[model samples]
Target: MNLESPKVNVTKSPQEVFNFLEDIKNFKSLMPENISKFEVLDDDKFLFALKGMPEIVLKKKEVIPPNKIVLGAAGGKLDFSLIGNIVETADGNSEVQLEFAGDFNPMMAMMIKGPITKFIETLATNMPKAI
Candidate 1:
């Protein structure tokens, strides 16, 4: 399954946004308020639990400075990738886009689509505030 989040216009420059996202632990700031059992395992990984969901570990997978960052599930039941794309706007600010892709069976996709979509949308919408 593939999901795209709304573009967010942030006051930070592209490089600044990239720098923030390069640290996997920063993701905790973007998580929904109800998240519990959060832990920062290392500079490149973190674990958190969402309501009704199994604990999840997110790890940094790849980073292209000032452009993109990719994170994936680490030792979790879900196999998924979360990508952050940063573009420099003409006004010296940045526009960030978030995308999520998950590997799941047809039945599983049907079961989780709504929640996953909302999750990614929330992440994208709240990122600028987090930064």
Candidate 2:
């Protein structure tokens, strides 16, 4: 299953946005106001817990300069990725979007899709504040 967030424009350039997101410690600014817990495990890893959800360890899986950052779940049995895609805009700003993808049993996908989509959308809307 896959869910994409609405693209959001930020005042910073793509490189700046990417630099901020590449740091695990900066993720807290992108999380919802209701975020219950957050911790930086290392340069490429962090742990966060949202209301009503299990604590999750997000480990950076790949980095593509100013374009993309791929993160995966570290401690859960679930197989998924949260991909941040960035593009330089005409106004010297950046356009950011988030994609959430997972391979799950159809039933399981159906069950959690709504919550996951909502989460990603919230994160995307908060993208302008990333830098």
Candidate 3:
């Protein structure tokens, strides 16, 4: 299923915002309670464990610093992709668009949709603060 996640407007510049959001070590601090731990194994890869949600061992599929980051993973029959976009506003502020899409296992999909959405919203709102 395709999900439209929240987009948050941050006061920081695009580069600042992007750096904060892309750093995996900061993820647990930015994300909501649902995300218990988010760890970065490298510059472009990470492993995340979610409480009461479908856990993902994500690998960076693409990265174009200060602008876009995409992570992908396979869970059983499901293929998941998460796209994070950081845009520089006209006023030089930053805006983040987080999109999560995947074909998921029936049971796991149903269980994770809401939590995942919450995760995105939390990330959008707190990423700038974390920076």
What TM-score does each of the candidates earn?
0.95, 0.95, 0.79
RMSD list, candidates in order: 1.0, 1.0, 2.5
> For model 2, what is the error of residue 94's alpha carbon versus the real structure, in angstroms, after optimal superposition?
0.8
For residues 12-95, could you state the per-residue lDDT of candidate 2 as single tens digits? Answer: 988999998898898898898779999999889999999888889999999999999999988788989999999998999999
Clashes (backbone N, CA, C under 3 Å), per candidate, total 0, 0, 0
Q: Per-residue CA lDDT of candidate 3, range 75-121, in tens?
A: 44458888888889999998888889887778978987987777777
lDDT of every predicted structure (CA atoms): 0.89, 0.91, 0.75
Off by over 4 Å in 3: 74-77, 105-108
- Provide the clash count, candidate 3: 0
Which residue pairs of candidate 2 clash?
Answer: none
Per-residue error (Å), model 3, residue 103: 1.4
Q: Identify the superior model by TM-score, candidate 1 or candidate 3.
A: 1
The worst-scoring run of ten residues by lDDT in candidate 2 lies at: 122-131
Which stretches of model 2 miss by more than 4 angstroms?
none
